[model samples]
Each structure stands twice: as structure tokens, then as C-alpha cells.
Target: MKTDQEIMQNIRTAIDDCTKGIDDAPSLQYQIARKAKGEEPVVKKISTTIVLVAALLAITAVAFAATNGIGITAFLSRIIGGWNVNENAIVAPVVKENTSKWLNLTGTEAYWAEDGLSVVLKVDSADDEHVVCYSNEDGLLDETGERGEQIAINGEMAPLDQWRGEKELIIAEFSPLGEGWNWYKRTDDGLFVIVTFSTPDAEALQKGTDVAFQIQDTNIQTGETEECSVTLALPAMTMQEGHK
Candidate 1:
């Protein structure tokens, strides 16, 4: 009869030999003939266990190869065919038609506009937040003077007298500062675009950085003195085949 220590040593040796592909007994053949006659056969049991483990490993390797693309052999070919595009195309210059009367309000030196609300050309110190354009829905400033009531910004409504500054106010009820003054409009392009400008201020300039962030490009542009320009990508519609 093998002692407990001897059985343990045999088990350890069997594990090591299995990993090294070595076999001290007939490969995976469990000779249980003696065991069926009431005799213990430990070696046969160890052999069966190693064979079962080896079979499992073989099956796992086959499954892994099938799931993960064996290697990068089809990498380039797959990407090219998977992604195809219509490369034939043309590039045309975008033209705009200007209709707003305020485009060149300061002077002819302003930036040229192809579309009244598509873009704005301005002299130096341009205010990118005051230009008026069409609004699809009710906006901060509406087309009718009647809807200017109840407008607010950052939760605060503009004071009546100071709404459009004293100069822009024509009537007490129409003042931008009025309780419901709407000084903004929503554009057909699905956005709100306003343009406002201010003269050089020592206090506003002394802050070093810009206090008024809405002034798109306040710096000077080439070929002109005191020139500034701002282009707004508004939500607009296009004709699709049948729709005009």
C-alpha cells in the first residue's frame, strides 16, 4: 500500500510531467482491471485527469482562433471594401445676397455682405451682437413692438429707460428697457444673432481682457483700418428635389 506522502509525491510528479508533455504511464489509458476486482488503481485515475485537461485545452484553442481573427491577414482588404465613397465632386464659391440696410451703416469700408443675416462686415470695434435678422419663433426682440414685453436675460429683465440707451428710444412704451422689451430675434437658421458696438472705453479697455465677449473679432483685419468681421452660421433651409 502506498503511504500518504508517496501518493502526494506521485500526484505532484504527474502534474509536472503532464505540463512537460511527458508520460510515465500509458498515455490516458486507465487500467482499471485490478480496481474492478476491488484493488485501488491511483495511477490510472491521474492519467485520465491529464487526458481530460488536454482535451479541454485543445477545444479552447480552436474556439479562440475562430472568434479572434486568426491574425491581421485580411486587415487592409476588409477596411477598404467596408468603406466606399463617391469621390467625384465639385467645389463652388458660396454667394450671399445682402438685404439689410445696416450692413454698411458706418461706411463703405465695412466688410461686404452677400447675405444680410448670413454675415456682417463692420468697421473696427464691431459689436457682433446687434445685427437684426428674421426669427422663426418669438425671440428676445420680435418683429412687432407689441411683443417686446417680458424679455429677460440671465433671469434679469432690462430696465425700460436704459434698454436701448437714451438715443435709441423713440417712445416710452417702445423703449428696450421697458418691462417686456424683447431686443433679440430668432433667425430662420434656428439661432439668435444680434450685433451691437461700443466706442473705445477707458474702463472697458482697462480691464485688459475683453469684458464684452460677444464682439466676435474685435481686432484689426488686413487692408483696412478699424475693420472687423463676423460670420454666423444660421439655421436655413435648402430645396430638396421636389420642395422649392
Candidate 2:
């Protein structure tokens, strides 16, 4: 039986040979080295060849695991260490927020990449019968159905149909990922809204930038609308390179 040193050497050689010519080989090598150093005692009784096979299998397993919903970019992020991937996008840390009587901001997340900027806001409302509406420009309909508008980023107009549109800025109802789900849960006090925004020029709404949202809180049962404007500070973002 080969000594531990020899076994480790063989494992290193096998990993080097297998990862040779790979673009992310350097990162893989570093991770393998770190793993091997920490696992020396655990593999002490194992044969050199078995160790080599196990290491190779580990690499394969990682690649395979990424295919099961977790993206390759996220897998690499975990191995190389840098960003956090959510829904195939590298997201920044959650930003703290303040609360208002109508809209209570819970949490915020933002991601900047070559594709564009993605922002997700978790919000709560106290009005059980209220419907939240958004507009990019002034002249939004007030509670009495009077048309009014608000200032928007870059003079862009909010999509006519907040739920479906190709507009630059869109604020839609949040639906959790899954199948067969209609109607969001309604509590005694309020409801939760997951607002997502995707825009090519997301950089405009940088940290400390206050974005004015023209919101109409309408009572669904009575058609009564309470129009209000809320300015939310864009949370700090964790910018990362775009993934192909």
C-alpha cells in the first residue's frame, strides 16, 4: 500500500491532468488542493487510485449537480467564491428598508450585470382591500379616477398593463415559483408583494437614488383609490460580470 504522501500526490496529478486546458482549471485546482489538505486524515486508509477516482467523481458530481436547477455560473461562484446566485442571477446582499403607513418595505435585493439590472422588493401592506398600482410618469389616475402623472426615471413611462408589457420599467404582481397557483394569500392585516424590476439602464437607480413611485391604493370592493407617492432608496448592489 502506498503511503499517504504518495496517495495525495497521485490525486493531485489526476486532478491536474483532468482539469488541464479548462478555463476554470485554476479555480478547480485551488479548491481541490484546499479540499485535499483538509481531508488528509479522512482518506488515510484509502488506496491512492481510489482517492484519484473519488476526486474525479467529485468534480463530475459537482457538474451534474449544477444541471438540476442550480446554474453552472452559480456552481462556479460557490467553488471560486465571489457572488451569490439566485434564479440564475448573482444577487447582492439584502438591503435594509424603512416602513410607511401604506407600504411597508421588508427587504430589497439588486443585481447588476451586462444583461441589465434586476431588483426584487419584498413589501407588506396594512390595507387588506387595497390594490397597489405603479406608474413611471406623472398623470396617474387618483383615488377618484382623475388622471395624474409623476416623474419617472429617464422620462420612461410605466407599462400600460403592469402585469404584461415590454416597457423599460415594469412593476407586476409577485408570483412565487411553482405550478398551479392562483390568488395570493390574504391576511387579516395585509398582504405581501414581491415586486421585481428589470431594466437595461438599471444603473440609473443606484444606491442613495430616491425613486418616486406613483402608487394608487384602491379598495377592490368599493373601487375607492387612495393615490400616493412613495420614494424608495435604491439599495446598494453587488455588481458582477454577466454570465453567458
Candidate 3:
């Protein structure tokens, strides 16, 4: 388990050792000119090429391990301080079973604010056609603006240009303002989404804080509402980020 710096250093050392005293350089420009002239351009031996490729692969693997590993791990890291969710969030991997037997929802990360809580949920459905989704303006409209004819919000059909903001929309079972918005994307294994809302009580949050919450979603096909409950407590920023 080498640190990034150590791994880089090891790669550098290997490259140097492999290319030791093998200065076949006529300069890159000159080598290219030689090749252009139909001459055998100066090149490293196959062993050296193999070493370089291996080193490159190792570097790539390290980079991926450092910050791009697995779906859930990267999901938590990516939204740690964005989307109204911040570092003060307590990120716990929660596999909460939804009411629907065909689908499963997991809370990968979340944060509690005075207003309420925001949770990142990953949905895995056995039947692709029976996937879970929270109907909103964005999801209703596709690239060709097809759903434009019939707009929907909060899993219910609404008139075109019918306005609904966070204040008017209350989504979660326990949230003061459910912050109902359709925000989700597809993943290889399942669907990734973020659920945010206002809490009934505005409680001051400090480090090592724990809070419980419930997130709900509806099926587009069957109009079935499913909920997953979870509690998260982790190191949190006491104050809103970028403020005193």
C-alpha cells in the first residue's frame, strides 16, 4: 500500500533503471526525420517498451485507486462538498431495503443541515422496466422534448409551465421542504440519485453529528411510492462552507 508519492517514485526508479546508460537519443525531432526518410528510427528495445507500458498501467491504477475506485466510494467522494451537501456530512454506506420487492435502494452518503438533510441513493432494480424514479420537470422532458406535452412534478402530472419550487414542494415523509427535484443518472450496476429536503426541526449541527431521515421515490410505470429510512452520523462542518 504505497502512497501516491511513493508509487510515483517507484515508477520513476523503474524507468530510470530500465533505461540506464541506453542513450539512443538522436533527439525526437531527428528520430522522426530519420523515420520520414525511410530509415530505421532510433527506438527503445522491446524490454524497455514493456517496462514503460507497465509503468504507465501502474500509474493509471494508482490514480484510479487514489480517487476513482468503485461506484459507491467515488460517489461519496464526489459529492462530499457540493450539491448543498458538504464535508460536515456523515457518509455511511447504507443498504436500506425499499418497500418494493423488485427494487433496492441504498444510501451511500448524506449530510444534515439546519434546514434538513440530503441523501445520495443508489437504486438497483431486478427489472429494468420497473425502475424507481421521482418524477420531476427535468425527468419528464427528454432530448426531443417529448414529455413536454404532458409535464409531471412529484410523480403527478401537471399543466405546462406549472411552477413549483422548493418552498411549494414537500417530498420526504419527515422533511419540512422535501426539495423535490428530479436529480439522478444511470450507472453500470444501477441508478444514482440525490435526495434533498428541509427537516421539520432546525437543529444546529456540529462535528460527529448523527441524524435519521427517510427518502421516498415513485415508480413512473406503476405510480408506486417507495421509501428508505437511514441515519447518518459523521464528522461535519459546524458552519456552512465558505462562510464564517
In terms of lDDT, the best-performing candidate is 3
Displacement of residue 173 (Cα, Å) in model 2 is 7.2
Q: Candidate 3 on 1-244: residue-level lDDT in tens?
A: 8899999999999999999766875557766778789897566667876676556655544454466444553343333323333444445545433444444556676555554455666655545444333345434543332445343433356553343221122122222134533255444344456655554234444444544545555443334555655554444444344311
Against the hidden reference, what TM-scores do the models get? Answer: 0.19, 0.32, 0.39
What TM-score does model 1 achieve against the real structure? 0.19
Q: lDDT per prediction? A: 0.28, 0.41, 0.48
lDDT of 1 by residue, 143-241 (tens): 244335432333366543343332222111111111211223222222122232223223432232121111211111111112223222222222112
Model 1 lDDT vs. the true structure? 0.28
Per-residue lDDT of 87 in model 2: 40
Clash pairs for candidate 3: 88-236, 88-237, 116-199, 171-178
Q: Model 2, range 1-244, lDDT digits (tens) per residue?
A: 9999999999999998987778553555665676788953333467887677557655854765566654333233232212234444434334333323455544334445544444434444444533343331122444445543342222355433351232222222332222111122122222223233334334554443443333444433345445454444554454456433
Q: Where does candidate 3 stray beyond 4 Å?
A: 1-90, 93-97, 113-116, 126-129, 136-182, 187-189, 200-240
